[model samples]
Target: MKLKFFGAAREVGRSCILVEGKSTRILLDAGVKVGEEEAEVPTIPNSMLQSIDAVIITHAHLDHCGYLPHLYSNGFNGPVYALKPTLEIANVMVNDYLKLSNPRDVNKDWQKKMQRKEKTVEYHQEFRVKDLALKLVPAGHILGSSMVEVRLGNERILYTGDINLKTTRLLEPAYTEYLKADTLITESTYGGDKDTWPPEKDVLSGLMKSIKTTLDNEGKVIVPSFAVGRAQEVLFILDDYMRSGTIPKVPIFVDGMIGKVNRIYRHNVIFCKDELQKRILMSEDDPFKSSNFVMIEGKADRSKVLKHQGAAIIVTTSGMLKGGPVIKYLERMGSDSLNKLLLVGYQAVGTPGRELQDGAKEITLDGKKIKMGIKVETFHLSAHADRPQLLRLAGRIQGLKNIFIVHGEERKMMELAAALGKHYKVTVPVLDAEYTT
Candidate 1:
């Protein structure tokens, strides 16, 4: 068996991996790295694209499944496999990426063709791709995120695709029962010593406190969130808090593509936690239909929402403040100290969100330097597992011998590799590196 690291090798995006077993080759997660001047796709050559037999997508996140249309546009014509909800969400995410990035080569025909080639599978259902067998288990990161388990001949390999071991308000924890693998490929997005998070109560407490402070001042709170996972999680948190009287009930203006994706999430509530599904099905407390949440219809609604009289919570997308309705909100409300900008996810380097987190008083947006006085606070509500959770996850897999850490910065990957080295053989591969077992 052989493994090639095409992308997400000692980096946090473009997660592409190739697994070759005898005469069969499978591509894992053909994604693209965002938050840069230009998005970066996997380094695999076009000539080698046709040689791959299949593509397995772990989730719908841009960094994990964004490059499928590009692959289709190039030359690859194999089947694309994922969960049903992953396919649904990926359609929205990839369409949004193409619209924003405007990659001239990928046309509408290629995107429609890619959509036609999708093959959805159920969790834990063993499927075959020629000579290799594969199954997907819940990753607990998002609605349809999964960890791929592959079996080739006598060897078993587990690929952790952006996992989360801790359960959140929307989903359950990752699946880890009786899993046996010889080789483990894991993501190290939060694999450093300093990456430990506070207790869930404390994290929520801090977030509510910030929101309450802004609302008490009769000011709006702008939360820049990823439309897929983070936005839904934040909405659920806000709804739960307000219903319990923990925070003031205010209008939550859902802008951008978040409302569309929220409907997809609601349609796929079976993949969520038992409690959430029960609430959606058995009672009148459907979180998605909460009276506090208001969907922004278009540019007119956005303008009207900004002019609302009293305190409100505006949850809009482009989570990293790269580009979206959030920017418009920031341009209008960011200079007011009474307003608050709450960040709930990781802010990559060079992003406007990261700049704000680093205490930048002024930032360049659309070629103009805008002064920011909106109180900024970050709550570590990340979807990835932290260092301790990663270690505990690694320790739970039975028959694990070799560990390969990917999808992280060099320092964090090295830190995780060093810690995992004591018990198992750990290797942090660089870009285009390969290993055989």
Candidate 2:
């Protein structure tokens, strides 16, 4: 088998990988990197597009599935396999990406065609596409996220796509028992030796404390979050804390695409953790429909929300503060030192959020430099596995001989490779690099 890296080889976005067996060629993911200036797609050649027999999507995150519509537009009409919820969520993510970034490349006709090619597969359900036997296991990163296992000829390959080994409030841990693979392809998003995560309880406590301080001072709290997994997780934390009297009751405004994705999450509770499923199905206390959480309908409602008298929590999208309604809220409420901006996910370099995190007092937004005094705080509520968790996961796969690390910065990838080099033949492939195994 041969593996090729088109993107996300030593970076954190545009994750595309091609696997070529003796008789079949499969694309693992076709994604785009949402950058400061423009989006970046994979580096696949035009001649290779028609040779791909099928595409397997590991999750719905834009970094893992955003470029799929472009594939259809480029005349690749192979079957796309994923969990049902991943497809539903990817529909929302890809449409939003088109409106923001590559509007001219995709049309309604291409979208319909892509949807017609979708093939939903359940966890552990074995399926065959041409010469490859495949199965998906839960990846615990988000709802419907999975790791792909492929068997061809006499070799087995396991691809870990944005995995989280530790369980959180929403999902179970990644499945890693009785799995055998000769080559392991994994992500190294947090693979540095110093990238250990704090305990979950402590992280939650710190986040609540920050919010409580702002609320006590009668200031609204603006939480810039990703629309899919991080937004939903933050909402649940706030609701659960409010119900337990850990924090005072306050209006949690849901903006951007978060409210729509929340409904998709609620509808697919079967993919969530056992406790989350029980809370949704076994009672009237659905966290997704919390009374304290209100949806901002339109511009009129957003204006009304900004004019409210008391303290509130606004959870909006464009997590990196590159775009979306979060910017509007920041413009209006940012000067107030009492108000707070809580970042709940990874902020990419060159983003406005990263600037704030790096202690920048002035930022340029849409060709305008704005001065701000809002209190900015970051809580490490990440969904990716840390260094220890990654090592633990690698230690579990039976018959693993080679490891390929992708989806991280160069330094962190090297650190992880050094750690894993003692046990296995680890290779950190560069962009467009190909290797045979």
Candidate 3:
């Protein structure tokens, strides 16, 4: 078998890997970089583009499955496999991408092309297509995230597409069984030596304390979160704490794509953790259906929300404040000294979130310069495994000959390679690099 790294080799976006067996070719996780004007896609050979058998998606994150519709525009017409929930979420995301990326006249044709090529697969069930035997295990990153195992000619390859080994409020930790493999493809998103995460308990306590301070001042708290996993986790945390009287009960406004995503989460309870599934089945109380949550139905609702007298909590997207309703909320609340902005995830370079975290006094948004007056705070609520966790995962994969590290910055990947070089041969692949195993 031969493996090729087409994208996301030395960088953290556009993840595409090609696996070539004796008789079949599979493309793993065709995706695009976030926040870029033009997409960075994988380079496929002309001979193999029309004959590729399958495209396996590990999750619905844009960096993992965003570029799938672009394939249909080309000559390739084959099955695209993912978990059922992934397809559902991707249905919403891919359509939204089309609206944003294309003009009104040409968007419909692109949307129809993606719909005809999508396929669904069951988790943990072994299936075969041509010369490849495939199975998907829970990756524990998002609602339908998975880790894929491919078998060909007596050799097994395990690909971890953005895995998280630690538990979050919404899902269980990543599956950690010692799946033996000849080669392991892993993510190095948080593989640097200084990437140790703070304890979850402390992080939560600090977050509640910040909210309490804002509420005490009769000011609103703006939480700019990713509309998917981060939003759901924050909602569950707030609801759980308020119900237990551990924190003040306040109205939480769910905005952006999060409201629609909540419905998807409710519909797919089977994929969640056992505790969450039991809460849905064994109890009458639904955790996602909190009375305190108020949905922002349209842009007209924004004025009413901002004019409210009492304290409130507003959760909205784009997590990095690059776009979406979070900017509107920031424009309204950022100049108030009593209000607070709580950041709950990694802020990529050049985003407004990173600027605020770095103590920028002012930022330009929507052609207007806004001064920063709200209290800015950060917490480690990432979905990726840190250094020790990454090493532990590498240690657990019984026998491994080659380990290819991707999905990280250049220095971080090298740091991970240095840490894992003691026992196994670790290679940090560049874009379009190919290797035989």
Candidate 4:
């Protein structure tokens, strides 16, 4: 067996890896980075790529599965395997990726070509295509997130796409027991010396406090969140707090992809915790359709939402404050001292959200200085594991001979690499690096 670091090596964007063994070549997660206008993808020899029997996607996150559409355009023909929800959302997500990347009449044909070649795999069900055996275990990150395990020619390999050990309010924890894999490839998104996460309660308390302060001042609170995992988690938290009377009920407006995504969440509620699904199916119970939430849609509808009076909570997308409705919300609410901006996800470098996290008073967004006298707070209610949690996850895997850390900042990966070096013998490979086993 052989492993090669293609993408998500020494960086946290595109996630792709190659496994060659048992007369089969498996390409795990051929994704594209969302940061740059142009991205770099690792290329395989035509001989090797043509022989690839399967393509496995771990989740629906763009960084982990965004580049899949490009693969269909690349002349590689093979079954694309992912969980049911992952497949559904991937179909939804990839179209959005193409539209956002190349939004023109000319690119419409390109999008159709990619969507034609796709397949779905249900959880716990194993399937064989050509020389590869594939199965998916829950990754506990999003609605259809999963950890992939493949068996080939008497060798077993596990690739955790993007895992979260701790279950959020909406999802279950990652399935940790492999029982058989000799080689385990794990995500180190928070793998580092400084990757410390606050406890869940404390994080929630801080989030509520931030919003409460804005509400108290009769100011608006703008929360820039990912429309999927983080947005749902925040909604669930706010819902519970509101029901408990911890926070006063106020007009809550959700913008960007959130409204459409909430429908996806409802349509596939079974993929979540059993009780959440029951809450939806049961009469006189609807957690997502609270009285306070106003799902903002279209430019005209969003403009009406911004003009609302009194205290309100605006949850918008482009989680990093890079673009989307959050920018519009910021342009309006930023200068007000009464308004508050809460960051509920990891802000990438050079992103507006990161600047706010770093206490930058002025930011360039939509060609203007988004000057703010408003308060800004950050909470790490992340979908990735922290340092101790990452180490604990590492402890759970059986007989790990080699560990390759991917999908993290260089320093964080190096920190994890250094820490792992203390107790276990593992190799933290480099960008475009290759090794044989």
Candidate 5:
């Protein structure tokens, strides 16, 4: 068997991997690179990509599945295997991704890149092509994320798209059956940090304290969250705080694509924690209908948020504080000492969000330099596991053979490789690197 990393080998954005064996060749994921630096769109070597057989998507996040359309446009005819929800969410997220990006770059290359799209499959479902048998399992990272196990010839290889071992407010714990594998390809988004998160209670308390301090001074709290997992979690945390009177109930403005995605969340409540799903099916415990989330509607109405009576909470998208409505909110509310910006997700290098978190006093936003005077506080609410949790996850799998770590920075990937090498044979591949076993 041979493994080739076309992308996401050195950094956390685009994730593309190739496996060839047992009369089958498959692309693990064709994700896109993101962040501030002007970057070239990623594609596989023309030599290997021209006649690809199939693609198995791990999740619907842009980074995991965003490059599908580009792949199809580049001349690859293959079925994309993913969970049902991954398929559904991918449709929404990818189309939105294309629509939201620059339309001005309509050259032949750009046109071809966006010309074709992806097909979706479901979980536990099996797909066979030639001699390959692929099974998708719940990954528990988002609504439709998955881990995949593929059997070809006599080899059993497992690819974790992106996994979360611990259950969150919205997702179940990752599937446990694939604890045995001959070859395992895993992600190392948090491989450098070992500290497990503090108790949820402590996190909640800290969030409340920050919000309270801002409210006392009558400042708005602007949170630029990823429209999917992070947004939902933040909203739930705030909802719990307000319902229990742990903090004052402020008008929380819901902007960006998160509002639409919330509907998708409610529609797919079955994928969430069973307890939460049961509550949704049973009583008046509708978390999405809280009075705090004043959905901002119409483009003209955005200015009215500043007209609100008291301190407000605004949740918008483009998580890394990169773009979207968060930019507008930051431009309007960022200079106030009364306001605060809480970063809750992984901000890649060179992103404005990362710059802010790194304590840049002023940043250029939407073509203008804004003095950042807001109280900025970072909380440990990442969807990815920390370094220790991931190491623990790696240790639990039995019969694990070759471990390939991807989806991290150069430093982080090396750190995880070193840590996991004490026991397992850890291989850290460089961009476009290939390994045979």
Candidate 6:
């Protein structure tokens, strides 16, 4: 078997991996590099594109599955394998990307092409195509996220696709039962030593303090969140705190594509943790539909939110503040000293969120520089595992011959490789580099 690193070898976006066996040529993920005006996709050679047999998606994140439609546009019409919920969520995500990037192709014909291409796979079940056997195990990064395991002949390989072993409010911890692999491909997004996070309670306390301070001063709190996991997590945390009387219950305006994604979350209750699924199964215990959670849709409602004066919390998308309705909310709320912007995820280096997090006094929004007077606080609510957590997960996989670290910055990947190398032969692959096992 031969493996190639096409994207995210020494960067954080555009995660893709190519695995070639004697009878199968599978692309693990063909994603887009986001947080920029022009997103980047994996560099697949034209000669290999048509020969690729399948694409297996690990999750619905844009950086993991956004480029699947582009594959279709390139005349590679093989079946795309993914978890059922991932397929559903990717439909929403890919359609949105198509409408935004390729408006000309956002019609019914394109939709039919996407529909005819997807094949759903159940978790922990083995499926075959030619000489390859593949299975998806739960990866606690997001709903329906998974770690792809492939077996060809006597060799077994596992790809840890954006995993998190620590449990969060939204999902269970990643599965750690399977303990053997000849070659292991892993993500090192937060593998640096400095990427350690504080206890969840402390992080939540600090976030609540910031929100309370803003509200007590009669100012609103604006949160720029990712439409998928981060938005749902922030909502669940805030709702839980409010219900427990730990924080004041204020109106939480759910805007942008978050509501639609949350609906998908509701539809995939089986993918969530047992605790969450039990609550959903109980009577009158819907965690997503709280009294304080107001669904904000249409321009008029958003305009009302921008003009309203009373203290409220606005949860919107484009987590990095690159685009989406969060820009509108920031335009109205950014100049006020009393308001707060709580960042809850990893912001890419060039994004507006990173600029603000780095203490920039002003930011450009919609081509206009806005004074950033609002209180900005960062809470470590990342879905990726930290350095120690990564080591713990790596330790679980027994008999690993080669460990390739990808999906992180150069420094982070090297740091992780050095740490994991102490016990296993580790390789920090360069972009487009190939290795065989």
Off by over 4 Å in 5: 37-39, 103-120, 193-195
Candidate 3: list runs displaced more than 4 Å. 45-48, 103-106
lDDT ranking of the models: 1, 2, 6, 3, 5, 4
Cα RMSD (angstroms) for every candidate in the order listed: 1.0, 1.1, 1.8, 2.1, 2.5, 1.5
Comparison by lDDT, 1 against 3, better one: 1
**For model 6, what is the C-alpha lDDT against the true structure?**
0.87
Candidate 3 lDDT over 348-431, as tens digits, reads: 767789999999979877668999999899988888888899888888876778899999988998999999898889899877
Specify the poorest-scoring 10-residue window by lDDT in model 6. 102-111
Q: lDDT per residue, candidate 4, 1-437, as tens digits? A: 78887788877777889887757777899877775354445554445656677788898888877777666555567778877778777767777777767623225454465555567778888888667677888989999898887777666777778888897888988888753566677788888787888788888887787778779889998888987788988888887887787888987888888787788887888899877877778867788788767888799989887788899888889899766788888888889988888887878777778888999999988678878887888888899878887788777777666677788888888888788877666666776667765
Output the TM-score of candidate 2: 0.98
Winner of 2 and 3 under lDDT: 2
Q: Residue 234 CA error for candidate 6 (Å)?
A: 0.7
Tally clashing residue pairs in candidate 3: 0
- lDDT of prediction 2: 0.90
Q: Record all residue pairs in model 6 with backbone atoms less than 3 Å apart, i.e. clashing.
A: none
lDDT of each: 0.91, 0.90, 0.85, 0.79, 0.79, 0.87
Model 2 segments more than 4 A misplaced: none
Tell me the deviation in Å of residue 300 in model 5: 2.0
lDDT of 5: 0.79
Q: Report lDDT (Cα) of residue 82, candidate 1.
A: 98
Listed in order, each prediction's TM-score against the native is 0.98, 0.98, 0.95, 0.94, 0.93, 0.97
lDDT of 5 by residue, 1-437 (tens): 78888888787877888888766788888888755543345558656666678888888788887777767665766677776667777767777776766423322453344333345666788778567788888877888888888777667778888888878888887887646677788888888745467776788689889888888787898888999888998998888888888778788898888888898888888778898988888999799887778888757667888666668889888898767888888887888888899998888888888899999989988678999999889888877767876787777777777888888887888888888888888888877667985
> On residues 156-205, what C-alpha lDDT tens digit does candidate 1 reach at each position?
99999989999988999899887889999999999997999899899999
Give the winner by lDDT: 1
